[model samples]
Target: MNLHKILIFSSCLFLLPYLNIVLFIEETTSNFYEKYMSMLLVCNFIFSVLFWHNPISKSIIHKIDGFFAKLSVVTVFLYVAFIKDVDPYNENIFFLLYLFFISFARLSNKHSRKEWCSNSHIFYHFLMHLSGIFGGIVAFL
Candidate 1:
């Protein structure tokens, strides 16, 4: 499939649970704050995926989204670190480093081919998957 189709498909896949979460929140809670926060999160998730289609790295929107991703990663680490007690405080540091690398990869897209090593795709996808899982768990709990 083409990149645009892949992006659209991925967005729809991510949106299912996202919408369910929002609907559940709306049904369970009356507070506008929580409701709006959940909506905002849904929007963020959609926009994050949309960033892949940005026209240029130098675009303001691209930089803003990059900053936003960094913010989300930090927020997830902090939530797990101090609030949820799901992981050690030191884990936040490691997460921050990982976030840095992700941002670097997204922003720079520069790295030696030698750096891929033997399990480059495996390791990269694994970490990406791990972060999403960690973030989801932290967000839910």
Candidate 2:
């Protein structure tokens, strides 16, 4: 992805977690978990912005971002797994799967051109948005 697309993608990824919190405030009755998750999401957003904006090699930035993104996913999964009142369901499973797919697509699209239909990177980003929304809905349940 170019810098423009990267910025947009980062913004969307940054916003979704907060949107999830706002949209599912009532469901997040567990204050500790909610706060912890929110903090992690915020940190992830900050990391994305900083890594993208820093004057470093694009390849290095991508590597760092990918690593942190995967770390965030694992952190989220562990958080949800250990937390109380979070019922494991198909949606949660799907969310994790979608996240994994997105990560894989991103890693595999290192040399992809920006073709909307054939570009797995763009498709992965689209799927990321959908999964974010789906995960938000699942958060309420």
Candidate 3:
């Protein structure tokens, strides 16, 4: 079985809804959260393009994707802390960090990092991406 195909197919499936929402849906809004959410979802498109362009360990594209994907959690959850009232998301950052640590733990086997585009990495990555996007939508909306 070609893990690359699994990576590509699953990644696209994971992002297909986002791709439509971000691209085909015409909208005008002043909501900062919406704009920020859109921006975070855009990272998925970037990763898709980069992976398709060069699905190699030598490429640093995933790092870019990882950085933004991971960063979005922090940004999305930030407004909660600023809310004048008691905020449920006060613990969101810590929760996300905990989840990330769980995912990072998958790197236990030394070969995991060596593969770069390995299936486990791809799976864990999309899980993080899914968690961030879904969590943002649930919490912010």
Best by lDDT: 2
How many clashing residue pairs appear in each of the predictions shown? 0, 0, 0
Candidate 1, residues 28-138: lDDT per residue as tens digits?
A: 543443344345456556665675454244567657655755555565455545554344554655566557556544433332144322244324433453445344433
Taken over the whole model, the C-alpha lDDT of each candidate is 0.47, 0.55, 0.53
Which of 1 and 2 is the better model by lDDT? 2
Per-residue error (Å), model 2, residue 10: 5.4
| Pairs of colliding residues, candidate 2 | none
User: Which sequence of candidate numbers ranks them by lDDT, best first?
Assistant: 2, 3, 1
lDDT of 3 by residue, 49-133 (tens): 5674566653588577656655655665564445323245635654564466446445522435766657776566555545544
Clashing pairs in 1: none
- Residue 59 error, candidate 2, Å: 5.3
Model 2 per-residue lDDT at 67: 74
Task: Tell me which residue pairs clash in candidate 3.
Answer: none
Q: Which should have the higher lDDT, number 2 or number 3?
A: 2
Q: Candidate 1: where are CA atoms >4 Å away? A: 1-40, 85-130
Q: Give the C-alpha miss distance for residue 69 in model 3, angstroms.
A: 2.1
Q: TM-score per candidate, in order?
A: 0.49, 0.56, 0.56
lDDT of 1 at 32: 45
